[model samples]
Structures are given as C-alpha cells and as structure tokens.
Target chain A: MLYDVFISPFAEFEFMRRALIGSFALTIGAAPIGVFLMLRRMSLVGDAMAHAILPGAAVGYLISGLSLAAMTAGGLVAGCLVAILAGVVTRNTLLREDASLASFYIISLAAGVTLVSLRGSNIDLLHVLFGSVLALDDDTLLLLAWIATITLLVLAVMFRPLLLECVDPGFLRSVSRGGTVTHLVFLCLVVVNLVGGFHAMGTLLAVGMLMLPAIAARFWCAGVGPMIAAAAFIGALASISGLLVSYHAGLATGPTIILSAGVLYIFSLLVGPHGGLVRQWAPGRHLEA
Target chain B: MTFALRFSDLTLGYERHPAIHHLTGEVPAGDLLAVCGPNGAGKSTLLKGIVGILSPLDGTIERVGVGPREIAYLPQAADIDRSFPVTVYELVSTGLLREAGLFGRIGRGERTRIEDAIAAVGLTGFEGRSIGTLSGGQMQRMLFARLLLQDSPVILLDEPFTAIDDKTTSDLLGLIGRWHSEKRTVIAVLHDFEVVRKHFPRTLLLAREKVAWDATQNALNGENLLKARRMVEAFDTAAHACERAA
Candidate 1:
C-alpha cells in the first residue's frame, strides 16, 4: 500500500525525476539574478518580463506543434522586446521608472492576450501560468540544464558590474569605460533568466521566487557576496521543499514553490535584524532612531 | 604640496549646447577653492569635469594629489538615493573600492581603514544602522565617513552645505577645516560668501565662460558677487520650476 501510494508515485516515475531536476536547476540558477533585481528595486520588471513570455510561447505553440522549444524562443523574443522598449521609454521620458514599467507591462499584457487568443488554445495553459512539474520530460530537462549553465555563466561574467550598478551607478560611471556595456549586458541576462524560470515557476511564481528570497537575504547579509550566496541558498531550499510538498500532496508545483519563498520573505521581513518587520514594527523603523 | 588641479582649455556641456567654453584654470596645493557662479554658469558641470565624473568635450583636467586610483568625491546628499536600505558600513565600504580595485578583496587593512573613516566622521558605533534612517545632518556625516575611507589627497565636493540647518552646516565646515589642515586639496562648490571668505584662500568665480579663476576672496568683489548671486538664484529657481509655474 505504501509503495502504491507514496514511494511508487515519486521513485518509480520518470516524469517526476525530470521535474525534480528542472526545478532544482531553475531554483539554483535563477536566485542570484533575483538578489540583483531586489537590490535594484526592479522586482516588478521581473514580473512583467515573465508575463511577456506568454504571448511568445502561445504564438510559438500556435505556429509549431513543439511545446518547449517554440515557447522558449518566443518568450525570449517577446521579453527582450518589452524590456528594451521599457528601457528606451524610461531613458527618453521624464516619467519615473515605476511608471514606465507599468506602461510596458500593460502593453505586453495586451499583446500577449491578443496573441494567445489567436492561438486558440483550449487546453489547460497552466504550464505558462502556474507551471506543470509533471509535464517535464527528458528533453525539457536537458534544455533546463543548459538554461542553468548559461544563466550561471552570464551571471558570473557580469556579477561585479551588476553589484556595483545596483549599489551605486554613479560610482560605476566614475570608475570605468565599460560600465555602460556591462549594465546593458546584465539587463539582458535578467531578461533571459526571467524567461528560463518561466517554464517551471510560471510568471507569477518565477517573479515571486526571484524577489522574495533576495529580499529576505538582505537582512542577514553585510556584503554583496554573502547576500548573493544567501539568496541562492534560500531559493534552493524553497524549490526543494515546494517540489516535495507538491509530490506528497498531489498539489500544483509552481504556486507551492512561490508560497515557500514568500513565507521565507515574510520571515525575513518580520524577524530580520536590520530591515526585518518585527525590528521595524515601531516608530523606530526610522534608521536614525 | 604642489598644484592640485589644472584644466587646460577644458570645454564641457551636455549633448550639444556648451555650458563652460574654453576654460583654463589651476589650483595650488593645500588651498580650499570655492567654485561660485551664476545659475547655468556650469559650476556643477565644472566640478563634474575636473573630477572625471563627466568627460569634457575638449581639453584635459589633470590633478596632482588625485592619482589614477585615488579620489574622494562627496556628491550632494540630495543627489544620493537615501531611500535605499543599505547599512552605514556597507555604504562606507564602497570608498575602499579605489584601493580594493573593483574585483580586489577587502582585506584586514581595508577593514581597519573603514573603522577609522567612520570614527573620523563621528559615527563609530552607528555602522550597523541603516542609511535610510539618518537625518540630513547624519546623512551628510555618513557621506563624509565614506569620503574619509577613500583616503584620497583630493576631495571634490558639490554643494555639500545646501538644505541643511545652520548647526549642521557649520559643523561640517569645521570638519572641512580639519580636512584642509591635513594638506589635502579641497574643491568645494559653494555659494555662501561668509563661509568662502572664512575657509577658502582661493576662489574660482565662473559665469559660463571663466570670469575669474584667481586667488583670494578679495577678487570676489561686489560685481562678481552679483553675477554669482544671479547664477545661484537661477539654479535654485530652475530646480522647482515645474511647481513654481503651477
């Protein structure tokens, strides 16, 4: 009975193993990018970029019968376009950064819904929204591994610039000539990671996982290197816990992962030493006091 | 002590419209020179150009004490993003970057210097506190702490005394005096004639074109003061221009 119920559902399953590997890779690879996003206060951009992939994935699926390949390509194209447009508008106009992001998200949503409707997908599109852990296959798992490698490589190359830019852009400009190029490259990596994470975590959960763990890590860390490491650890833990819960309880995986990350975020928000909620619960929330 | 800075035919502007045209100036070492100018006279631009924050359209800016790796830049407190949740220690550690050299590690020696910088700025135990919670005075002091950590021979300050209480301003002024005594060349972009006369032995009076790049406050006569006042007022007016119109 135990074999039929618990062990068999998890151990005896190939799809489960693929899903496990994909989830682990996504969690490990995408977390450091989240720390930067939170530091830059551009968590909303991650959300918009995640959702921006939907129309691309939908359109690709509509045109081609292949599921994972078409969606990834389509998502990348859509996300990059939206991100560039947002960046240009923000740079050109006097509008605040948040306002520009909001405008871009609105446009991307409109475009995605229009295209998705055109694709005439009557099937459960939870893979794009909530993500399907069970649907992961050997091929998709291999692609996810590549995604992890590329994400880590891009992050490792741009890590210094990304941290500097996030902490003090003026200092970066004052220091080196390559600052502009490095910053643009980092943003491109952000777009790619958002797209890569979308397959397992879904748009909402991808953003949630990216931001929550990093925000939580801020309370525990003194320096940039430690913060990045802490954020990655938090992400990996949440992803593992989420997958385990999803497997044992027969619940959805994406929301479960996000919930775990979000819970950690709340813990940090409330109990963190520096910016923690419980610490700042009083008027002493003001750092000076 | 030798000459601190030399700007040779330095022209600076944004995109197309030139702000300061063909300006040449030099400062002797150990002198606090207040750069006073009329609004749109490019005082900030000049500061930016000399300090290598903003590249000049033409010509060169060379400084003696400021090596290729050493500089202490105190940007206007308002210009910094105070809303960020970084701790005082984290913010101050950035000053060590010049010595740490981007990818270089922050060793024990660097850590020791960071503590000294914080103490120099009179905020020793406040390292754990978040930067966002500091008052305007405390915030400026934190900036000073960071500058102290840089340990550079030349310090470039852009309107450090703006929008603060008289007490804080005067306290900072006294700190500047102590800094000057250390023989570091200090270039302060300021408006108050009283502070300039009391602190700076040299003055650079500018009006888009270089009007006076001479020594002593005596050069800042009534006419120069009038032009400087106009420029400073115009800048003060232009900043909130949108609200003033409404």
Candidate 2:
C-alpha cells in the first residue's frame, strides 16, 4: 500500500516523473525569491506580477498556438514591462508603487482574459490559467533546470547588496553604487522565476508555490537564510505529496499542489516554534536579560 | 583653514519646491558643527544634501578629499525599520561595506572590528539579539556601533538624541567626542538648545535660509533664535516658485 501510494505512479508514468522534477526545480528556484518577497513586503506585488504575466502568455498563445517558447517569452516581457512601468509611474507621479502595480495588474488580467477568450476555447484558457503538469516536455524541463541554476548563482552573487537593500536601502545607497542595480536585478529575478514557474503551475497557482511556503517558513525560522531553506523544503514536500495524491485520486495537479502548501501553512500557523498559535498560547519561561 | 565641504549657492528640495534655497557655506575639517533650526526648516534636508542623497537644485557641493562613500550618515531612528529580522551583529557588520565591497570576504580582522564596535556602543551582550528586540536606546546604540564601523571622515547625525534616555545620550556623546578628537568632520541636526550650547562648538542656524553661521554662542543668540522662528513661521508652502536675480 505504501509503495502503491508513493512509488507506483512515478514508476508507471514518465509524465509523473517529469512533473516531479519540474516542480522540484520550481521550488528550489522560486522559494527563496518568495522569502525575499515576504521580507520586502512585496507578496501582493508578486501576485500582481503573476497576473501581469497572463496577457503576455495569452498573446503568445494566440500567436503560436501553445508553443512554450512563445508563451514564456511573452510572459517575461509582459511581467517586466508591468514592473518597470509601475516603477516609473511611482517615481514620476504621486501614485505609490502598490497603487500603480494594482492598476496595471488589474488591467493586465482583464486584457489577458479577453485576449484568451477572443480566439480560443475554454480548454485553452484552462491550460493557460491552471497549467498542465502532464505537458512538461524535455525542453520545458531543461528551461526549468537552467532557470533554477541561474537563480541560485545570481542570488549568491547579489546576496549582500540585496540584503542591505531590503533592510536599509538608504544605507546601501550611500555606501555603494550597487543599490539601484541590485533592485533592478531582483525585479528581473522575480520575473524570470515567475516565467519558469508559470510553465508547470500556471500563473495563479505558481505564486502559491512561491508565497505559501515562504509565509510558513517565517513562523518556523528567525533568520533569512534558515527561512529560505525551510521554505524550499516545504515547497518541495508540497509538490511531491500533491503530485502523488493527485495521481492516486484523479485530481487536478496545480491546485492540489498549492493546497498542499496551504496545509503546511496552516500547520505552521498552529505549531511552528517562532510565533505559532501553540507557542503563543502556551507560555514559556522568560529569559534572564 | 582646509575646508571639508563647500556648498555653492545650494538649493535642495522635493520636486523643484526648494526646502532650503540659495544657501552658500563652507565647513572646515574636523569641525563639530550643529545645525539648529525650527521644525520644517530643512535641517534634515540639508544633511541629506551633504550626504549626496538629495542633489542640489541650483548649485554644487565640493568635497575636498572625501568621496561619496567617505560620508557616514545616521538618519533618524524612525527612518529605520527596526522590525526587520536582522541581528545587531549582522546589521553592525554591514558598516564595513565600504571596505568589504560587494561579495568581499569578512575575515578575522573585520570580525574583530565588528565586535569592538559593538562593545564600544555598549551593545556587546546584545550582539546576537534581533534588532526588533532592542529598546529605542539600544537601537540608537546599535546604529552608533554601525557608525563606528563606518569610520568615515565625515559623519552626519540627524536628531540622534530624540526620545533617548540621558544615559544613552551621554554615552553616545562620549563616542562623538572621541570622533571629534580623532578629527572627523561631524555635522549634526539637533533640537535641544541646551545640548547645542553645551556640546557643539559651532552652529548653523537656519529657517529655510541661513539665519546665522557662526560659533554656537553667536548662532544661538536670542535675536538670531527669534529671527529663525519668525522666518520659519512666515514662509508659505503654497507660494509660487521664488523668482530672483541670477
């Protein structure tokens, strides 16, 4: 029964194995970004950018008829455009960043749904909105792997500046010339990860893989490094359990994965050591100051 | 006297609305200059301008030997997000960024410096604690520890003693006195006239424009103090842009 629940589905189907690897890659790459997003208080901005990528993916779909390359390229462009445009408006006008991003994403989502409905059927829309785990080809797998590698390498290189930018941007700006570049590079990282993730989990559920685990990690870990590590692990666990359960029960894969992450989040909320409900209610001995 | 900073008819503001306008001045090296003014007199704006955070709208600021990185700035405590998840050690260590550069290794020597700086600021026992756990006084001390590690030739402090306990203030002032003795150019925006009179040697009195730039005693004179208040109260924020002779 254990083997049937765990190993049989992956052993029986090449698609299941591909899905597993693809999601593992996505979690490894996207989860750290998720931690930073929460730290920077940009969780909703990440969500807005996720929606902002939709119209671009829709445009790509309309042009190339389900071509991965076209959709990814389109999504990347659209997400970056929205990010840059929102930034520009925030700097040039009285509108704040959250306000600008909200307006642009709302418009992008409407435009994307309209564009998808204009030419395609509901099935195509479902594929775009809620992604197909069964459809990850070798090229898509390579893309995910490459994206994960690049994310890790770039994050390592920019870790110091990025941390400074998050905690004390004014200090970073005064001390070094890398502050603006660090910010732009970070935004690019968000866009690239979202683009890669949208291939497997769809834009809607993709951010769940990014955000839910990160949020859960906050309750478990105190430091940024451990929080990121914890988040990645939680995301990978969710991906695996969700994939196995979906296979056994004939359920949709993407939402199942996100729901699995949601479960972990709720669990962390209840029992995590840092600030969980359990810890809060059950008082511990005070430390000698 | 060798000048550390020279402002040539400087105007600093947000969106072309000048907060401090047509100001011209020079700061001699190793001068402990206090910037005293009424509220909204652009005291913080002037410090920001000197630190290169805000560019001059009308003129230039020539630094003698100090580069942009050579200026250490301590903004108001309210400006920092204390709730951020960082240890005092980690935050204090970042002061070495000028020497470390991006991705540079923090070797044994740097680590020792960080510890010493923390100890100097009376935050040795609190090194491992998160910044959020610190009280306002401890937070200020931590920032001073960071400033110590910064070790810049020019130090700018903005309202450093506000809401701080007297003990912490005195302790921090001792450190500032050490900086002055070490010949670092120290410029601070201070509100307390007594503190200014007692500690600061020189003072620049301002109210959107310069009222007096002289020794602390002269700058804090009753007439100049009253003039600064009147000037600050008389200014109209909604008034049109100043039209003046070139």
Give the alpha carbon lDDT tens digit for every residue of A21-119 in model 2. Answer: 999999999988999989988998788888899889988988887888999999988888888788778766899889998998888879877877887
| Shift of residue B152 alpha carbon in model 1, Å | 3.9
Residue A25 in candidate 1, Cα distance off native in Å: 2.4
Indicate which candidate wins on TM-score.
2
Return the lDDT, model 1, position A215.
Answer: 79
How do the predictions measure up, each by TM-score? Answer: 0.78, 0.96
lDDT of predicted model 2: 0.89
Error of 1 at B164 (Å): 5.8
Chain B alone, TM-score of each model? 0.84, 0.95
Clash pairs of candidate 2?
none
The docking category that best describes candidate 2 is medium
Q: State the C-alpha lDDT per candidate.
A: 0.73, 0.89
Task: Give the per-residue lDDT of model 2 (tens digit) for B24-66.
Answer: 9899999999999998898999988888888888888899888
| C-alpha RMSD of candidate 2 | 1.9
